[model samples]
Structure formats: structure tokens, C-alpha cells
Target: MSRIQGPEPERRLARLFRSLAPAERETLLAFAEFLAQRGATTPEPHGGLREPIPVPRPTTESVVAAIKRLSKAYEMLDRGPMLNETSALMSAHVLQGRPANEVIDDLEALFARHYRDYRAKHLSEG
Candidate 1:
């Protein structure tokens, strides 16, 4: 007797995931959790996943620099819809004197959430 196969997409995804680095693997898992929580009334911050990378706290880093760094880190996310929220957070940090570390953490969460939303919307369309 032989083992049975799952759906083609699932098989393909598994293969793709197997080829990723440990950090990338964690990022993918986090994104999957985000997708799973899409229907919830209120989603938790950071999709409740372990931190994949340490968010850096450079002394000279501005909020804009943090946004750019996070954008590069989460390249899969769509940036257009996130502009408003990102701008607000940047304002809170710059004008309101919010701590850089806290603002950067929130920025990471924001990017993750937006990526989840983007995936949920587009994945269903295909």
C-alpha cells in the first residue's frame, strides 16, 4: 500500500516552505496565522507568533527609516492601503514624542496585519 497525497496546492506550498531559511519559515507561519484570524472580530497583535527577527533600535533611526526597514522586511505586503495607518503612527512618534522602540514594534504589527488582509482578499479572488 502507498501513502496518499494531499491537494496539489498544499503539496506545492509544503515543498516551497521546506526550501526556506528558519527565519523565513517563521515569517511564513506568522502570515498563515494572520490569514487564519482574518474573520475574527478583533485580531491579536503580531499574530501571536514568536519574533522572527529582532527589531533594531538604532539611535539615529527616524520613524520613516523604521517604516522603510519594515517594508523591506515584509516585502509581500501591499503598501498602498497601509499608507494612512503608517502615516498616523509616524505622526504619533514624531509629533507626540512616542518612544522609537514602541513605535517600531507597532509598525511591524501594522505591516503584518496589512499583509494578512491583502492575502485574505486576493487569495479568495483567485
Candidate 2:
């Protein structure tokens, strides 16, 4: 507790959080939890990333469902770098009238690519 800088940042965060809509607040909290988990976890004893937990995609899925599936399937990968692309694809589906199947296909490809990159980087580092 004493290591915490102060309440200034927490106060600021509270103010910003209060300004967001319910959905946006949920998003903010999820991102914060993701960050906290990312910092908390360490690699396995083998000095490599944990194997991805496979969650098979269902037929005729929604974009939101795809995002959740991919996030689970590729849990070993750092999602920070994928956020921009992920959000863009999500927006394309939600706001730009993109097809759900197409968006989900792109999302699967994006997660696969990120996993490949994570493998190379972690393997080389190991």
C-alpha cells in the first residue's frame, strides 16, 4: 500500500471512468484487467510461452463472439499489439456494414499471425 504513488492517478482514473458510457466502462475495466494479468503472469518453467488454448470457432458467429473466441484461443499471445487491428476490424463490422463472416475470417487470420510472431520471438528469446 505504501508503495503506491498516491491517489492522484486513481482519482483521475475515476473521473475518466465516470465519463464513459456503460459499455465503454466495461471495455475500460477489461483492458485494465488484461494489463494487470499481462504483468502478473510469467513464462512456464520451459522458458516458453504457454500453448494457446484452442477454442474452435462455431459456424455463423458474430464479430463480438469471434473476438472473444480468438482472445481465448490465443491467450498466450500479448494482445496489446493486436488491439488496433482488432478494434479496426470490430469497427468495420459494427459501424461500416462489413459482413460478420468476413470480419471473423480477418480476425482469425490476425490472431494466427500474432501467434506466429509470438512463437518466433519467444522461441528465439528462449
Candidate 3:
């Protein structure tokens, strides 16, 4: 019988990536960043969500503004899961008087995690 050998894993991945659209390629890069961060002992507090570098708003910037800014910055993320966490953080800020910056920090982490999750799910399907 003739022997058969599958292509190398790297080769397979290259082929898969090459077939993706530009938007999909960006998703793949985001996914790669997520995976790389997963192995770190202390992941950057912001995760990979800081891309485009959020403009520095004054301390007076409303919590709502921060949420809107973050949502715009991470438009690639699936919004369903994020809505829940975001609502809770908003409540904490509005009802419990949590600091705006503190809430925004949590929001950043939440968006990053959701994007990572989104990437993982989509990558497996593709």
C-alpha cells in the first residue's frame, strides 16, 4: 500500500488564512492576539481592546460616553454577551457610585474577553 502524509500544520493554517476575506483576516489576527495573551502570567490590564488607542477624554466624560467609545472601538465584537456585562457595570457606576474610570476599565476587559470568545467560536466554525 502507498503511504500518505498530511500537509504540515503550518501549511494547512496558511492555506486556511489565505482563503479568508480581509475582514476575516482581521478577525484571525485578533484571535491570534487572544491566544498569545492567554499564556501570559499577567495579561495587560487592557488586553487587546486598546487598539486604535481610545482618545483620552476628560475626567468629566460620562460613563455612557466611555461605553459608546469602547463599543465603537471594538465593533468587531458580538454584542449580545457584552450587553449584559455592560449593563451591570453601568448599574454599578450609576447606582453604587463606582468610579467612572474603574467601570471603564472593567468595560475594557469585558469587551476584550468577548472579542476573544467571538474569535474562538468563529475560528472553529470556519
lDDT of each: 0.63, 0.75, 0.64
Task: Extract clashing residue pairs from model 2.
Answer: none
Error of 1 at 104 (Å): 0.9
Candidate 1, superposed: residue stretches over 4 Å from native:
1-62
RMSD of each: 14.7, 4.9, 16.1
Rank candidates, TM-score, best first. 2, 3, 1
Q: Candidate 1: deviation at residue 96, Å?
A: 0.8
Pairs that collide, model 1: none
> lDDT tens digits, residues 1-126, model 3?
874467786798889999988755654554444433333423335443323335565667666666666665665555555556776877687668898789878977897787677667656755
For every model shown, the clashing-pair count is: 0, 0, 0
The residue-by-residue lDDT of candidate 2 on 1-126, one tens digit each, is 365578998999999999988755765665565445444435567775777788888877767667777777777777778777877886686668888899889989998998888888888997
Residue-level lDDT tens digits of model 1 in 69-121: 67555655545566667767766775688887787789878977876776676
My TM-score estimates for the predictions, one after another, are: 0.48, 0.66, 0.51
Cα deviation at 118, candidate 2, in Å, is 0.6
Q: After superposition, which runs of candidate 2 have C-alpha atoms over 4 Å from their true positions?
A: 1-43
Give the Å shift of residue 16 in candidate 1: 48
**Ten residues in a row with the worst lDDT in model 2?**
34-43
Best by lDDT: 2
Q: Better model by lDDT, 1 or 3? A: 3
> What TM-score does candidate 3 get on C-alpha atoms?
0.51
The weakest ten consecutive residues by lDDT in model 1 span 35-44
